[model samples]
Target: MKSITVRQLADQFQLEVLVGEEQLQREVTKARAHRPGLEFVGYFEFFPTEHVQILGKKEINYLHALTDLERNLHIGNIVKYHPPCFIVTSDQSGLKYLKRYCEEEGIPLLRTKLRTTPFIGALDAYLLKVLAPEISIHGVCLNVSGIGVLLRGKSGIGKSETAHTLIRRGHRLVADDVVVLKKLSEQTLLGTHNEVTKEFLALRSVGLVNVVRLYGRKAFQDETRIVLDIELTKWRENELNNELELEPKFVKYMDVSIPHIEIQLQPGRDVAGLIEAAANNWYLKQQGYSAAEEFMKRLEF
Candidate 1:
């Protein structure tokens, strides 16, 4: 149910407000734009009234060719539907009547200098990003070896400490505590830091520290595409070991599957080194080099 106001769109694109100053707060619920070409010719059955109406060169020319009475009737029919707003592309000069009608009817009208194709593309891109499905996860996300690694575990499992060590080793932290995950597409999930805890990492005894200020801007990144998920587990007695040479596992978030790995924590273990090795191994796998598979082939020979 998220919506963007006509005023917000105008400000974002720096579009000229042709009329309907009082209707600036009108909300557009749909991301797609509709061309009123058919609607102008008395075909209003399947018209998209919730989307932003776009008037381009052909539609304007058609309007100009119509007789005055016909044009008025067509425009009046469209106005009665109460579309979210109207955008006239290319800044066409013969839109005086359209502008006057919109002003009198209090329908927000905007003008942009860009052609129809480019304007629609840009607007659609922005709206898709703003309205994309999003979810927040409790984990620490970092860019390790150019791969986004998400660390998840219980509260006292040292996830923050491990991330801090990784930052010291020249890795960048994307988020801590709560990571806002946005489904960019069917197979892509983007992770970003929560606004309240951005750039700040909390440690048990050391208290809160700003990673950006302490380790420079390179130690923190705004967001990253999450490609790997790692869960830290406490070492327990008589626990079964998972076969590392088997096919990779996956974790689903927002209906997208990401490669998943689990690491057990024990005393006297170099967790940071292990994480770095995991990232490098992931990179190698991406490049089609699997050490386990190679070793199995050698054993078979």
Candidate 2:
């Protein structure tokens, strides 16, 4: 919904408005074109109407030969135009005639030296993040029922060793390395791949192994709601005033909120048992029961 005017574009790229200074203040809803591969072009289609476009060096000559109607049509000016501006990529003064015509007709022109590809790529990536939908769902997300529970223990507290036991307990692997998160809506967080990553878990002794081949397709989920976020920390023997007991705490990502569970990792603890318990406890909460609150009410009685 936000837009940049021709004057703003000139300020952004340090380009001078050669002609149509009065018209140069027109707002551009989208980039007409960008240096290919840049992230700037993807936001163009988001507005209700087409606003402005980048007129590169290649198309400058063809535009000058056209008549009034032809000039308007070829320059993408059909329908009730929102008053378009141009980002001229070249510095040549040969286009002065065209500039004179534009000034007479009150069309704005902006100049920039950056190539087409790189500018567009940057524009696209930014728009994708801005326009992406985020959502939240209460579904259990795991790989092979174990392995890669993603334990984040304070240095040398035993996350890798705990994962080793979980692997030995018949839980296959998905990704022990890095997990990628996708924002699907205003309230949905979907876990997926980072494109450049492979579906493998890397342990210290063993480097990397393909999870799909070993655990079948079930271990590699395309996407799943991040219903739980378990953070592992060193054990504490003090009072358990704020210890989690199946009570849901939501985490926000890309404007969406998702339930999270933080578990403490420690020595001699049955981690596999705890993982299963966490999953089961989440199920119970989904079914409308709260063990911690229920036990507290009983104490009052």
Worst 10 residues of 2 by lDDT: 35-44
**Which lDDT tens digits does candidate 2 get at residues 183-256?**
64566555644444445555556665565676665546544455556556666677335653534576566666
Evaluated with lDDT, which candidate comes out highest?
A: 1
TM-score, per-candidate, Cα-based: 0.82, 0.47
Q: How much does each candidate deviate from the true structure in C-alpha RMSD?
A: 3.1, 12.7
- lDDT of predicted model 1: 0.88
| Pairs of residues clashing in candidate 1 | none
Considering summed lDDT, which 10 consecutive residues are worst modelled in model 1?
237-246
Candidate 1: list runs displaced more than 4 Å: 35-47, 56-79, 237-244, 280-289
RMSD over all Cα atoms, model 1: 3.1
Q: Give the candidate number with the greatest TM-score.
A: 1
**Which residue runs of candidate 2 sit more than 4 Å off their true CA positions?**
1-174, 239-250, 293-301
- Give the deviation of candidate 2 from the true structure as CA RMSD: 12.7
